[model samples]
Target: MAEPSITIRDNGPYVVTMPVEILDAKGNPLTITRERITLCRCGASNNKPFCDGTHNKINFESQVSA
Candidate 1:
């Protein structure tokens, strides 16, 4: 059986609700999921990739102007 994969939607807030196994660079399991998670993409988060509601402070927008 293959390991379960999580889908990350582009230009949107990445949310993870299900239990998942976090891994290290060497394919080793780092930690098991205990709660929900939200990741940031704007690079303005003080949490550095983790949602800390800081995106709102810097007016971080994910949509690109075409």
Candidate 2:
């Protein structure tokens, strides 16, 4: 079983990137890929679940966790 992982970038429009396999409720893989994905953290992206450089206007801040 391969575990999925997400990476958060500080200098990019995407707050987080993850290689995911979309699955059904029963854990069946859907039509998804293992490619890198960008997620919006500023909550102002017209494209949900993806980053569109909307964070620049909102001045989003992220706290680094140790």
Model 2 per-residue lDDT tens digits across residues 1-66:
335566566644443224455556788865545455677666788876568887777777774444
Off by more than 4 A, model 2: 1-3, 11-19, 23-34
Give me the displacement of residue 62 in model 1, in angstroms.
Answer: 1.6
Evaluate model 2: give its TM-score: 0.55
lDDT of 1 by residue, 20-57 (tens): 66566788964545466666766777764466877677
lDDT of 1 at 59: 73
Which residue pairs in candidate 1 collide? none
Q: Which candidate should be chosen as best, given TM-score against the real structure?
A: 2
Error of 1 at 55 (Å): 0.6
RMSD of 2: 4.7
Look at candidate 2 and tell me the lDDT of residue 15.
30
Poorest stretch of ten by lDDT in candidate 2: 11-20
lDDT of 2: 0.61
